[model samples]
Target: MVWIPGGTFEMGSDEFEDSKPVHSVTVNGFWMDEHEVTNAQFAEFVKATGYITDAEKPLKPEDYPDVDPEKLKPGSAVFTPPTHPVSLDNPMLWWEYAYGANWKHPLGATSTIEGKDNEPVVQVSYNDAQAYASWAGKRLPTEAEWEIAARQGKPATIYYWGDSLKPKGQWPANIFQGDFPWQNTAEDGFTGVAPVKSFPPNAYGLYDMEGNVWEWCADFYRPDSYTKNAEINPKGPSSSFDPEEPGAVKRVQRGGSFLCSDQYCIRYKAGSRGKGEVSSGGNNLGFRCVKDK
Candidate 1:
């Protein structure tokens, strides 16, 4: 873990609608994990508690009565890029509900962690992450804490490193290097999840803080969260709300993922934000933990 000194800085971005109304935020010094939780770490937590992630639990028809029961089978969303370019408007083109896809089987039943123990554990729901944090005697970082750590006492720019995606023609993080969902040049030496510390650490000595995988934060999703604008360590909205998906309870996700590309999802930027259903986990979503000073 690394220590993040308390300070105030601008939060949110004007580039995205949800990250608008950039405002001032203050946070206190705290200890944070230097990288996303790895598969090996999560495996230990599960072994100790006999824990089962939400993705492994069967979905009840009553919870999703409108959907087909067959499609509601236990699964998590996986990114299977197409051979050719497809409609960017439809997320279904790349996201597939892969049955048996959990942290253990990231790609599906046919996949396994195998020798990738150092890779960040994906397909972990917010609850699963919370449970792991609890077992470790830590807690999920608030969105404010996450941003502060990611920024590393630097001025807000397009990314944690700087405004340029690839500064000095060098890839600072692991992000999709080609046309998203259809092409990947692997310019950063990875088409999928890379091992922890695969990229350079931020100014605060935090690794994989910009890309590689999206990280869960302890905050409910709300477009107008900035409006609340608590000056000292704002803890996010009291409840979740997303106008796009009103029925689903969502939590904030930060740092983006390897799937993020400038041509499509540019969420890897420092000031950008993302959200996911509390019960839903994806092959690109994971989390880290924090502790009090």
Candidate 2:
């Protein structure tokens, strides 16, 4: 874990609607994981506690009463890129719900984590992340803490490293480098999720703070969260609300994923925000932990 010496920093960006109206925020110092939780770390937790992630558990019939009984199988959303150029408007073209896709089988039931223990574990829901944090005697970081840590005492810029996407003509983080969904040139040396610390660490020595995988945070997501005034150690809104999906409860997710691209989702920009349904897990989402200091 790295000691994040927290202080006041700009908390939002003008690049996105939800992150609009940039604001100031303050936070206290905390010990944060230097990198996202890896397959080895999570495997230890599961082996010790016999924990079952939400992706591995069968969906309760009562939870999806309207859905077909046969469809309520254990699985998660996997990023299945299209073979040809497709409209970016519909993400369903590239995202498919793969039955039996869980943290153990990142891509699907047939996929395995063998020899890839250093890679960040994906397909972990917000609830599953919380469970791992509890077992490790740590907690998910607040959105504020996460932002400041990612900033690394540097001024706000498009990329955590700086305004340039690639500093000195080298990929500083793992992000999509080619056409969205259809092709990934792997210019960053990674076509899929990169192993933790594969890229250079931020100024604060935190790895994968901007990419690799979307990280779960400890806050209820609200589109207008920045509008509310909680300058110091803001824990986010009291409740979750996404005008687009009001019925689904969501938690704040930070950092972006390997799928992020300039042609599509650019939430990897500094101060930008991401949110995910609490009960949902995906191949591009995972989390790290933080300890109070």
Candidate 3:
């Protein structure tokens, strides 16, 4: 864990509507994991407690009664891009709900993490992440703490490294490089989630703080929460709501993921906001932990 000597910094961004108003936030020091929690770490937690992640357990009919019972089998969302270009208007173009996909089988039943223990574990829901954090005697960072750590004293910069996405043609993090959701040039030396610490660390020595996977934060997401946030140590909104999808309650997600692209999802930016259904998990969603100091 790295000790982040947090202070006041401008949170959110003027570029995006949800991240608007550019509020100033103050955070206290905290000990943050240097990298996103890895497969090996999560495996130990599961082995110790004999725990099963949401993706590994059978999806209950009562939870999703509207969907086909056959489609409600144990599974998670996987990014299976189309062979040809598809419209970006629909997210289902590349997201396939693989019945056997879970943290153990990242891609599906046939996939394994035999030699990839250090890679960040994906297909974990907000509850799963919270469970792991609780077992580890740590907690997921609040949205403010996450932003403060990702900023690493460089609060106003667009990217963690700097304002430029790639300075001198050097990609500082793992992200989609090509036309987005269609072609990936692999310019960042990664086609999907790269191994933790595969890229340069932030100023505070936190690795994968901007990419690799969208990290779960300890906050119920509300699109307009920032407008009502406390000036100091704001946790998040009292409840979760997304105007675009008001039916689903969402938790905050940060950093972005390997699937994020400049042309499509520019959420890789330090100030960009991401959220997901509390019960939903995805191949590009994972989490890290933090301890209050």
Candidate 4:
């Protein structure tokens, strides 16, 4: 864990609608994981507690009453890129609900984490992340804490490293470097989620703060969250609200993921925000932990 000496910093960006009204936020010092939780770490938690992640649990028929009985099986959203270019309008083109896809089998039931213990564990829901944090005696960082830590005492810039997308002609973070939802040139030395600390750490010595995998945060997501006044240690809105999906409850997710690309999703940029339904998990999403100081 790294000690994040928190202070006031600009917490939002005007570039994105949800992150509009760039605001100042203050936070206290806290100990944050230097990298996202890895397969090894999560494996230990599961072995010790015999914990069953959300992706591995059977779906309650009552919870998904409207869905087909067969479709309610245990699984998660996996990023299955198309062989050819496809319209980015609908994410369904590249995302599929793979049955038996869980943290243990990141890609699907046949995939294994045997040689990828150091990689960040994906396919974990908000509830699963919370469970791991609790077992580790830590908690997920609040959205304010997460943004401030990612800033790393530096002034707001397009990227965490600097204003340039690729500083000094080198990939500073793991992000898509080719066409969206199709071909990935892997110009960043990674076609998917890179192992933790594979890229240069931020000024605060934190790894994968901008990409690698979208990280779960401890806050209910609201599209208009920035419009509300929360100058100090803001814990986000009291409830989740996304105008696009009003019925779905979502939590704030930060750091973006390897799938992010300039041609499509650019949420990896500093101060940008991401959100996912609390019950949903995906191959490109994971989380880190923070301890109160």
All candidates: CA RMSD (Å): 1.0, 0.9, 1.1, 1.0
Task: For model 2, give the 10-residue run with minimal summed lDDT.
Answer: 154-163
Clashing pairs in 3: none
> What TM-score, to 2 decimals, does candidate 3 have?
0.97
Model 4: runs farther than 4 Å from truth? none
Clashing pairs in 1: none
lDDT of each: 0.93, 0.93, 0.90, 0.92
Tens-digit lDDT track of model 1 for 89-184: 999999899999999999998999999999999999999999999999999999999999999998778788998888999899989988878999
Give the Cα error of residue 255 in candidate 1, in Å.
Answer: 0.7
Candidate 3: tens digits of C-alpha lDDT, residues 225-248 = 889999899999899989989888
Rank order (by lDDT, best first) = 2, 1, 4, 3
Poorly placed runs, candidate 1 (over 4 Å): 68-71
Instruction: Tell me the deviation in Å of residue 289 in model 2.
Output: 0.5
Question: Given candidate 4, what's the lDDT at residue 257?
Answer: 91
Tell me each candidate's TM-score: 0.98, 0.98, 0.97, 0.98
Query: Cα deviation in Å at residue 191, candidate 2?
Result: 1.0
User: Model 2, residue 214: what's the lDDT?
Assistant: 99
Alpha-carbon shift of residue 90 in model 3 (angstroms)? 0.7
